[model samples]
Target: MIIQAYNFLASWQLFPEKGEYQSGNRPKSGYYRINASDDKSRLNIEHTWVTLENDAFNATFSIIPDGELHDFENAVLADQFKASIADTSNLEISFYKNDRETLHVLHQITPNGLLKITQTGTAPAGEQFTNIEIYHKQMSVLPYAAAVSGAVIRPTEEGMIRHKALTAMEEQTNMQMDQIRRQIELLALQAREIVSRKELSMLIYNARLNFSPVIGQVYYLYEKKTGDHQVSMISPREWGNGSGPFKTFVAKVKLLADHTWVEVE
Candidate 1:
């Protein structure tokens, strides 16, 4: 065979076996529990090895009722035990009894999954008291196991999603109400302008007139008496000297060719 620039495969080997693609040494840590089954803290593993397969096995184990929560207590277990065993079908756990270190009553999500506590004593796991952070007020003692059962104070994924949905709905409703209020205010302003124009048109039409009013001519409206109104050719500025025909100036208007009264700018 011709050699490549870097390397070359000169010949094919004669073999009857299939090639092994990968070959490397891996740590067998899971078997440690099975080998040390006789030991007290061997963690009570059965003959089954499926749980330890491909597992890191670096995970440590600890019991409940510790006065101070260490690394294994906080990392591996919840603060309180709900004593939930309903979903134990999917859990991968193995435990042995140690009154000192073994948590007979477990409420934690282990690295493999849920905990399976095996008690070696006659006491029913409930008698064990866990580390409930206690503070004495008057006449109290340390390590008081107050068993209260109701519901776990844990926020769920569905609850968080519902909260966000309600918040968005509230914001949307407020915006719609503000838009409706603005529309109502605009309608009120338009109504007021219409009423003012109608009153002005009525005054000019009812005023006394001896001559025919010309189209496109500006005229001033004034009050003849306290209640009576009139139209005049003289503007308010020109009425500065001896203008007694009308007293109070009302508005300025222009006559349209259509015989309809229109106000001047």
Candidate 2:
């Protein structure tokens, strides 16, 4: 996915000859502001404000950056300072990870297409920030469409098998997560108001550990204060092992729909 963010302030510039303030470049008397937008979220106009005097603005916005974005800014381009790229007039942002496009942002060819924000700058300490600023005079609107032609399609035996396994894994994981959540809720209810922090922590931890026990895994737990010294927790795959201590313990959960056990293994 190719993902990018572009922010611009709509402002009218005054020349030295037509100057209104002593600075000549930016007169305090003129009225100027910008309206910016993007995917992921919308900015409330009432919440958006720009400090004309500081040539800075604050607004609400969001972007879904590609996995490559982390690599681009952090790894390959680490040494480049934000000031060096602060003057970009326009930005063409594309995000891809492992050869798949995840997001794409194309700036319109309007006055707003002049500069892009790819650097970090200090702002007033208390402002909640979410977007970057860009400077441009013209922006061109690009046709927005999602492309999936490059995605790999599985057709071979191994590929089909792998796809089936992944589908099964996803379903199993979802089921396991739900079952674990319910178990945790029940255990929390039972352990509520426990005076000891250590006891509560152990209860929660054991509940989580048993929430989704693997098929072949054997879990061991013990406490010096408890009368029962040790416990051997086993899954269905370990059924062949001879029975040992039948301690007060929770069992691991099995999430696969194909399982026939009355309770999760």
Candidate achieving the largest TM-score: 1
Off by over 4 Å in 1: 1-156, 210-218, 241-244, 253-265
State the lDDT of candidate 2 residue by residue for 162-230, as single tens digits: 334543664677689889999999888756533343443344344324345444344544332343333
User: CA shift at 202, candidate 1, in angstroms?
Assistant: 1.9
Q: Give the TM-score of candidate 1.
A: 0.35
Candidate 1, residues 1-265, lDDT tens digits: the string is 0111001001111111211111111222111011122322222211100111332212223222212232333322333221212232211222222313333332222354222222221223444432211111111111111111111223235433433453355457768878998999999987875666666677778886656789888888788865677778888789775446666777788776766666777
Clashing pairs in 1: 65-130, 65-131
Each prediction's RMSD over C-alphas, in Å, is: 28.0, 23.6
**Highest lDDT among the candidates is held by which one?**
1
